[model samples]
Target: MPETSRPAHPLSADEALRFTASRATETTFFFDFDGVLSPVTDDPDASQPVPSVLGVLEELASRVARVAIVSARPVSFLRSRFGSLEHVDLYGLYGLEVWHDGDVVTEPAALPWVPAMAELAERAKAELPQGVYVEYKRLSVALHYRTVPHLGGEVERWGHEQAERVGLRIQGGRMVVELKPPVDQDKGMVISDAVLGAGCAWYFGDDMSDIKAFDALRAREAVDPAFFGVAVAVANPETGAEVSSAADLTLDSPEDVARFLADALPVLAR
Candidate 1:
């Protein structure tokens, strides 16, 4: 981990490890798929969890009471990626969707926003900067500006403008800007609901939107004295500092995340 990060407030690494070791099975794990489990790629389709990450998740799912992924990606996408991992819960589009036991559960309010989403997709192609293309997921749209690094700010500004016009909210993730319905769902709400009865909860992420989830973990501790939460931020050049500053601990990369999980098995087993 880099020594430059200024975490908002976090348990020391030793303290967090000791706490998790104290009550292994009572711990619930939450992770963001992109930049946490899988390295961020220029092409989203090219992204997949490293083999070590997949194996570690499989093992953790068997041992932990709950292991969930709450991400901006759609339920269908998450289902395809993590469906094989046993005892894993998938919440996509933040909390607007839930894919459990192979069934998809979506909020009713999201349906009416479909037409507007389509219009945004069209406009993105016709109006946005070149190399800044729109990825149309059925329920939402993501404007990717990764291939055109210099146009990031312009794409983001345009994304926000379009989202406002379409009455959708903007979720800023790695190298992309997502436009989705202004529903009451987000990573924060997802974690808040999932951690209800958990003795300890950990959320690992590496994006601007993930800060909300990190805050949720911290907030739960204030409400329940015995609740232990760990906010882990993965280091990336763009928003790594911000995420790390808000996290309990910072890991160097997806490889480190895999190693962390693989190494923690024994500690958790104890």
Candidate 2:
């Protein structure tokens, strides 16, 4: 099969409806939190889902076999962000943690890597350029330069170096650099595990970390001819070129993603 290029824009409501209808029998939906459901902000702590997102997700979850959030944030952070919503399943730490049914299940071994990551973040703050900022997320460390665009390249290189030295992986996102343990648990792995052999799945995201999930879903579809799904990218200016190219569809922003989800649920549920 020939590889198709990624679309520059999201599917229209009609297109989404047709796509969903085609996979009505076995469809699951996975989402990313920041920039997919919530707007991206200078302060990550200030980011929150649009008022309607939770309601839309709740409705969509009732219709689909599963609704999971695969995010780069820690499971605890994700819980604090959207734990009140009963319908959504949370996959945090870039898939290292899973929260469901009011219970948090984690890969205990990954816990030990937290302090090491923090130390790396501290070193980045001290060594990187003046504009570079580090976010120590216990299980992950993010070097951010959104506030200082000129330092983006410097921060990115510093993050890569730190990851190499620590034997961790570098996950680049919008205006940020993340370091995490070298694990096979990526967004795609998390979605694949959550679906449990489901024939169809749709994943929406807005950053580089989401590319793994897109690749995983596409690979699964290739392996099983009956599998069908779409990888939707919410296009923010901050998103990397590689991430945009890897997506099947690209929406304008978090608002657009919410609109797409809201419109798709009713038809998909039928």
Candidate 3:
């Protein structure tokens, strides 16, 4: 079950954006890459941010105290897709690796997991279904099943078997299962760190894995309601139910996100 199973009333986008605008400089904004910024593609290789999204990110990065792109993708992939945005901090593989100002910093402790990830990737390539492909991220391995949705169960089982043998953990996302070292970091931890000392924060995401961040916001707000943490769900057919249920707000699509950011420009500018 997701951390926050019950749905809170959806936040009014207008009010939420305005709230963010009011504290623009003191707000730290975090976003999940795949579904929140890019249109989800069956082929991960084809996953790219909407043409206008990057420009919006650049704008927001300039206005917000900080902007981060936290994702399950590898730092290389995140760099390739979003490196041009110099001001944004990019965290990949759920924060085991981070890229900022052209330098990529990977957790030194995660180095030992490299060989196991490589081995699992090779094994998955041979053992998994035809449409199921493995992505080797050096410190982690992800089995993608978007092209073969029914293969999700098989992939999950195989991932579990490998994780136990390799001393790793399973992180499930939309039609994807990842094997990574049991790092203490997650999207929630990332959000917690990002919001430190900030007046307000907001996170936008579209997967069950993202529930951790929503729960983090809930945890924080429960302690101090003045420190606002808004959770925005990017509506999608596959994972919208759980994501929206946990989110304080829901946007229809990546295009809606782009529009939200675009509309937010004037608010922050003034």
Q: Highest lDDT, which number? A: 1
Candidate 3 wrongly placed segments (more than 4 Å): 1-10
Ranking by TM-score: 1, 3, 2
Q: Which runs of model 2 end up more than 4 angstroms from their true locations?
A: 1-16, 22-25, 129-131
C-alpha lDDT values of all predictions: 0.84, 0.78, 0.83
The TM-scores, one per candidate, come to 0.93, 0.88, 0.92
Deviation (Å) of 3 in candidate 3:
31
**What pairs collide in candidate 2?**
none
Candidate 3 C-alpha lDDT tens digits along 37-115? 9999877888999899999999888998888888988889888888788899999888888887778998888888788
Report the CA-based lDDT of candidate 1 relative to the real structure.
0.84
Error (Å) of candidate 3 at residue 243 is 0.7
In the order shown, what is each candidate's alpha-carbon RMSD? 4.6, 4.4, 5.0
lDDT tens per residue, model 2, 1-270: 212332223445465456566555566889999888899888887788888888888888778777888888888888887877798889888778888898888777788897898788778777887766677777788887888988887777777877788889888778887888877678877866766677668889888878888888878766766666678888877664667788777788888888878877767766
In angstroms, the error of model 2 at 43 is 1.0
